[model samples]
Target: MVALILILVGCNSGKKGEAAAEQKNPKCKVETSLFGMTPEGDSVMLYTLKNEQDITVTITNYGGIITGIYIPDKNGKTTNITLGFDNLEQYLAGHPNFGALIGRYGNRIANARFSLDGETYTLAANNGNNSLHGGVKGFDDVTWVPEVISCDERAALRLSYLSVDGEEGYPGNLSVTVTYELLMDQLFITYEAECDKATVLNLTNHAYFNLAGEGSIRDHILYI
Candidate 1:
């Protein structure tokens, strides 16, 4: 089950036009701060992820989304290498790829319904008669209280959310904590949860990457 969670949760677009845009203005020095919020008052924070080489990644608390990744290519030039929408509205609308935290059962459970104990429970069908990430509002879509951790070398933002009973048709109230730690070369994610009643839980962040730092990684190289 954890393996499945790793797949959906464990982890973009333009190239030419992007280079032109970057030439106009080199990106500012990477920084960390509170970005903004939703009309509903949900808080969003941003973190800068740096690699051993000082390559950077910009991530936001909104849906735990990755807004940008600046990596040094073979030539040592920094390029924003991840795919994502320009703003929160686009993210709220929908996303096929880019970055998103998945939850309440990361993958399909067959027919958007499951049987727990002696009773059967049905979930909202958000994905073709199936439930995708705890119905309409999953853990990824909620705001979490954030704690920023830092050191001279790296940084992390610990985030957590509480899911109420009947939220997205799931049983039991669940308290979940997810951590985003930026290490030298990897964004280590930790997800922990507890529930008052029996329920299913799956969590992962969807982030496509190209370690080489350019182009679609699908054709770059893949194993498993």
Candidate 2:
């Protein structure tokens, strides 16, 4: 899996609309509001972080998903550069795990089972006969505890979750924290985890980027 580090260089540009008008502070700041509630009656909050560079990113406690990323181009036109839904219902309904945080195991485990310490473990076979992304209800389908970290010129949101032993057939109790930090021209995602027992873990963020804001990617070219 790739390290979830996003660098938005030269993003210091003027923006219009409510996003710009809401910038009462000239420095970095994070604000929160009710995004929605899960079927389990858990409240999910939306966090909006605006850096000094005028880049704005919206994240939800539900799955720690990135809902929007607004950055201005050289022409001073700003658009959301990420693909995601506008509300919580769409997410609960599911749509390719857009902007979600994957965990436990990122890719797939063939036959939905693995052997460790001479013992065999069976996981959820959600993807064909394999275990895909921690099973049917992975970290992406749960609520996370959010904490805001403010510095002189940067904003960060720390999302923490605890996975108990035998969750989705995974052994050991795991504690995970994923932090999204917004700097002048960069967004850093840091993942940290600790387990009481020996268990496999792989974490990553699934975020689709479109520099042109939205639409087809056939004409889009990647540098790396």
RMSD of 1: 9.2
For 1-224, candidate 1 gives per-residue lDDT tens digits of 00112111221111211111111113312245667778797656666655455667677777777777676666777777667767777777777636767777787777888998987888888889888766777766776665554333444455667888888888999988776655555556778889999998887777766555556566665558
Candidate 1 TM-score to native = 0.77
After superposing candidate 2 on the true structure, give the runs of residues whose Cα lies further than 4 Å from its correct spot.
1-26
lDDT per prediction?
A: 0.64, 0.82
Which segments of model 1 are wrong by more than 4 Å? Answer: 1-31, 211-218
Q: lDDT of candidate 1 vs native? A: 0.64
lDDT of 2 at 109: 95
Stretch of 10 with least lDDT, candidate 1: 16-25
Any idea what lDDT model 2 has? 0.82
In angstroms, give how far residue 20 of model 1 lies from its true place: 32
